[model samples]
Target chain A: MLEAAGTPQEIEGRSLWRDARIRLFRNKAAVGSMIILGIITLMAIFAPMLSPFEYDQIDWGYIQEGPNWENGHIFGTDGNGRDLFIRILYGARVSLAVGLLATSVSLVIGVTYGAVAGYFGGKIDTIMMRFVDVLYSLPFMFFVIMLMVVFGRNIFLIFIALGAVEWLTMARIVRGQTLSIRRREFIEAAHATGVSNFKIIFRHVIPNVLGPVIVYMTLTIPQVILTESFLSFLGLGVQEPLTSWGVLISEGAKVIEASTWMLIYPATFLALTLFCFNFIGDGLRDALDPKDR
Target chain B: MNAIGKKKAVPILSVRDLKVHFTLSGTGLFGKERKLKAVDGINFDLFPGETLGIVGESGCGKSTLGRAILQLIPPTDGQVIWLGRDIVGAPHSAMQPLRRDLQIIFQDPLASLNPRMTIGEIIAEPLVTHKADLGKEEIKARVKRMMARVGLLPQMINRYPHEFSGGQCQRIGIARAMILEPKLIICDEPVSALDVSIQAQIVNLLQELQREFDLSLIFISHDLSIVRHICHRILVLYLGNVMELADRDSIYAAPKHPYTKALISAVPIPDPEIERNKERIVLTGDLPSPTNPPSGCVFRTRCPFAKDVCATDIPTVDTINDHHQVACHFHERM
Candidate 1:
């Protein structure tokens, strides 16, 4: 309409993703959490290597000592003679892995399963959703204990079990999302173009539903970590020599009166990490919508 | 890419008694089920390069008819004869080849486009799906070309649909529909969602594209004024039934059916003198629920001069002159 419409160089194109990312960075709490998470993750990886005492190494010199610099045990030794700092670092690796990998496993399974069920409505949707409902009714911890009993306490199996259990909710969320998305005009437009149903589900349906799926995924990671911790408390998680925050916390909780630092250190790390994830989740939910989701 | 051959004798699209009925199941245990006849037995023939306007009220099934013809919503019965082949019950594989020649432009311009996809990907989707052998460069070139043709700047091809205004989004929709160079495009109220100023631009763009590509269009809308611009012939539908079908000028000047007359009268003239003096025949009462539509004639309940006979026997379409058909019992007397 106007000849002086902004020149190509003047008119910069901004994608929704770039805008969301910019907004996400602008949130002070989310940015602070991200920086803290990055620092913690880096410390978790490198801090253990720099420590003089091995995570499992027992020093008969400083047994049940309070946090004192004379011993070079900054976080102090536990009821055992091992350094608390190195063990917490080791715990960080296990907990973060369980959180991320388990959540990824669930995301893959849930997104595909839900998208297929919702796209192919009618009998297929009913049967698939009913199956999900059946899974939902199962006792989560009881079956998880059973898997541990049968599989001999493999940490990988814990991931699979937690992921499998966690995906029921993800599948339900994705299915509900897909149900609404399939009726959207874009999906019909895809059909009008003669795109195969298979292509439609993967390309058109899944990508649009990913916003909610991603928000749900951020929240699910913390839940998965907490579950792993609970399992460890029950003595079914990572075995001896390989410790997690859960293992550290359970060990520390028993002798809290004699040594409160052991409980406080792991508990602080756990709470801070979980809060970071929750805050990040809230920021993403806001940023993704940008129009007040 | 389209090779235009004007076949005056044979129609490009022949929708013969096409009906798309939906059965709504009961909500509770004792709730009664009912049939909603959205598009009940509509007949029309669209010749090559001609524009057929379908104007009706909100629930008169204008959209259902457009989707039915494109097989977007599969028809319940009757034939959608395209190029001498009935596509009503055609399988997906069989329809894929035919889809290249048939396309539709949706009403909500922004909603019709995938938010995740760029304008280039959205417009190139049909080409990528139908033309399997096209290289990436070739497809991109074709997409850009189509974009330019639809009055969109080629530089904006990579932008998302949300980045564009309603008029620009409709242009993107048109580029997508026209990229395959389809023979017939069912524009399902394509401009209804745009601003009034933008509506004229979109309509003009559509007309320009139609002329250049030799495209036949079945333009459907609830607004009769918008349909009057580009349509060669116009059809009047009341409650999924065609009340009248005639040339655009005849329907506007001397409408035979009362429903058509009311619709025509509702269209405001631009001049203040003519608009103020025009006798507007405003129909009372809302469109009846399609589940329990009137038995004999769908329009009889709403008709101003409805004789007792209008409610007993259904009025079949009567041919008044060359291709001018009216479905009213008192058309001759009126």
Candidate 2:
């Protein structure tokens, strides 16, 4: 028999989450994106303190001005004479909030629904998954519009509307993952121990499925952000004085031929944020893959 | 305990005509419904402190039998009477307390321990669940004691299962199962996945633990030699049906069933001369598909002494002696 190694191997303690974090940091692109994302978040929180003018403050004399160093409007002014820089900064707060809040709502609902359906796995699974299938066939945008019309054009309601629609795919992903995880021997061992089904789903099943869920979350954030942009572009999201990146870009599009900086600034930030999210999502997928180890 | 005294003691567990048939998905919408009789109408009794070895080929339902007995998977039909209570149809709430008394060890040790949990947490789970009143200090003390008892170092408690070797992982699995001090533990090929040298170590650890706890074990394995080392009663299964069941001494000394004889002959003798001289009775074909087993007797198609009558009627188990039973039509002449 092999004796316990004389050296007692130095790797005596390490967790999957810890190791995954290490791997994630090692990817230069992921780290770079993380830094960019951090900077964007800070700028969004400190926008009011940092900007010289309020996002809605209009200087009628400086209307449609372009990149003037003298007046300190670095990126220039919009058609409404509002400082474009502050508008883009304020827009980020709404866009990021919508992305994060809606995605989180979807996360909780998806993981719970999927874990229950997958772990119990019988007539319950059949019924629950079929329900997801039915929802999948509905026109999601139309449903969101209906919700907006019924509930009024509140921004928080938009969070719920998008979250309620987006969770279908998350449920499908988590359910597929949970279906395989429920068959694993640890799950069987948990069942043998008489751990209540609810406890087992959360403790054993959900933790095992988190790798996929997390990777999918990064990807889903960008999708949620884009969906919010689409809603705002359609004039249904974040009304007038409260600006979003989508609202700025839509406002900029009208004067793209006359003045280019209006469309250029907000669109650049939106594209950069979306690109960073995709990079981080790709990095997480590779890092969490068991085959990589 | 004397053999006679042990026989007179009330059985700790009794399985009566347990059937676990799974319906297979049909190929086409109109394809006929098919049943795979994974564990077809099997019965056995387990006594306290005795290791009942269930030996069979792969796909012969040995694992299914173990799971069915523990009610991990609901059996299709029959009774799993534990201490006189029929648990076959027991509700999950009713089965919770019973699960504390009946535990299980699995085939793959690493796969059986959750990768996300520390070894300490994995072993303490049963205590936290069933012995909810146990204080943190008490739970830690018990977990540390169990880790040492299974030959794992107490200091290694915080590590995840992936950091351990296969043998050490199996030790963790053993520690987890034994922590609850269960009355019965169904070991489903616990050592089959380990190296030969490691297999002996695990088997010895299990035996030592069994003696200390007076554990009643349903030791399932396809390896006959390993089963011979730890099992008190030997049950030879073929295609989900019992071919022979007898005490180790009787079954090894004089196997009555033809299937039992063939299985015993396959065990390679240690001595060179005896190994060279012994005759081997290798079965001719692969195990018949459970979905379409041979008519009447499941094993008739593979039996060396098969006859027309063997194909027409299922053979009932015949009592050769008080301690031995053979399920074959012509066991007397065999």
Candidate 3:
């Protein structure tokens, strides 16, 4: 689209990555979602510092009370008399951190493993992919619980556990991408130029597969967040004082009739965050479309 | 044999009995593994500075032969002798140095270039791979020079392949191949993906560069018109086997093999009167599956003059003269 020969306006030619970046910024919904997501992430980070009361501290004076500006418990108190607003912020921290960190873990493990298998192909491909298929067949939650039990329930354990599961899909996605990409002319051209096999896999094969990898990454974040929430809902995730969106929502559910405001706030934040991520993912898919160019 | 005394220059590359067969094993149990002999027993000798055009229809293993020669697709059997050294099964590391001498220019100009890379990076990749000691500044300067030679503006070095026109993209592909100053370049239908108007320009550029580099070229294409213009000699392939090899003038003026005759007949003459008046040898029947090709001569099934001998015995390549060869059981009579 950036024809350099005749156009006077053209100074520097736009690389596909740069063009994609420009397109992403131009998409209003994606831009707005990024802004909103940034705000929520910031809010989650500063929740402890911003909130006047501790997340777990009970205000006996306003026990099970509705939101009131007088006490600064705007989102009101839970059945335990803890401040709802600060608890939601703390939950945001756990939820967002799980989404981002777990995806990063999967991205690292999945891309490298998948690129190696796909680029080498033949017997190596069969062996590696079958190994992935075996991992895929294992019961998802059982694997997570086993990891959690063995690792002593640390939050970092959750990151690895979710990542371990999500990476199977990631590996598959990247493998399928590179299977086609390896046969692409550019890759063959790379080989013809005598680029080492490892170099080709890491350089040519991996970067070309990034478009799909990134799209899957955005999808995986929300999926990980939801799974973490489900684990928390079952009371198996993030122990006592530490709270997540899932934990808050699950707690809010038990006291729904008595404290409706408690459920409303965290659920709104969780839904809004998921919505924003989906929009951003859609924007990315469109932006990175080679066909569109 | 009519003989004459002459000084013979040693061939730079000789491919003897080079075969590339792929066995496609079935997915399920008791699946039969079928042998697809893509380029079976191809033989040719390329002299320095000579352009050998390989012309064949689709699925004739023209591209396969080129790749097999380069060792990109390892040949299942036979010898690819490069300067008297057999390199058919050479290890990747051992072949790294050989790759510098045997570069390839691929069809589909845009696809051959890595889209993520800029024009500068794409052209510089071969230099970076082969010449590890060359400094980045020197590489960049060499790349800029090559771009100028290939007719691409050096200022557009940072632009991606998608940003360039098809013809321009092809120049970039050529620049990549020419950068290393390889002795031989196997151009696998390099201009097939370009515009008809642009094909001649690319072809002319290749010829100009060939003279500059003293390069032996294996120019493969389905287009005979373009091939005749640039190639010193032409080899016609039919179903993974050579049908004829002759000098450009002889092959065009007097084709001995039926398949070559048919192929040349299909080429439209530039003059309208000659084009309309010329006989077009339109052959019937689809190309037989390579898995189970017709026995003896592969072209016999559709050969207009096929005899019982053509079916029972394979026709070996026979020399008509020092520079011409043909494979037909009845060539002497025909």
Q: Name model 1 segments beyond 4 Å from true.
A: A1-12, B1-8
Interface RMSD, prediction 3: 4.8
Question: Tens digits of per-residue lDDT for model 3 on A1-293?
Answer: 12343432213668778988888898899999999999999988888788799998989988889999988998999888899999989988999999999999999999998988888888999999999999999998898878877777778888888998889889988988889989888888888889998889887888889998998899889899999999999887898788999999999898898788878898999999898999899899889994754
Please give the CA lDDT of all the candidate structures: 0.89, 0.90, 0.89
Q: Rank the candidates by DockQ, best first.
A: 1, 2, 3
How many clashing pairs per prediction, in order?
0, 0, 0
lDDT (tens digit, per residue) of candidate 3 on B92-157: 878988888888888998889888888888999999998989999999989988988988778788
Which candidate has the top score in lDDT? 2
DockQ, per model, reads 0.55, 0.51, 0.51
What residue pairs are clashing in model 3? Answer: none
lDDT of 1 by residue, A80-182 (tens): 7889988899999999999999999999999999999998889999999999999999999889989988879898998899999989899989999999989
Docking class of 3: medium
lDDT, candidate 1, B219-319, per-residue tens = 99877888888888899998899999998888888999999989889888899999999999999899999999997888988889998998898899998
Candidates 1 and 3, the one with greater DockQ = 1
lDDT of 2 by residue, A1-293 (tens): 23652344333589998898999999999999999999999999999998799999998889999989789788899988999999999999999999999999999999899888887889999999999999888997888888888988889988988898778888988899999988899989989998988789888999999999999999989898998998899998898899999988888898899999999999999999999999999899888985864
In model 1, residue pairs whose N, Cα or C atoms come closer than 3 Å (at least 3 residues apart or on different chains), thus clashing, are none
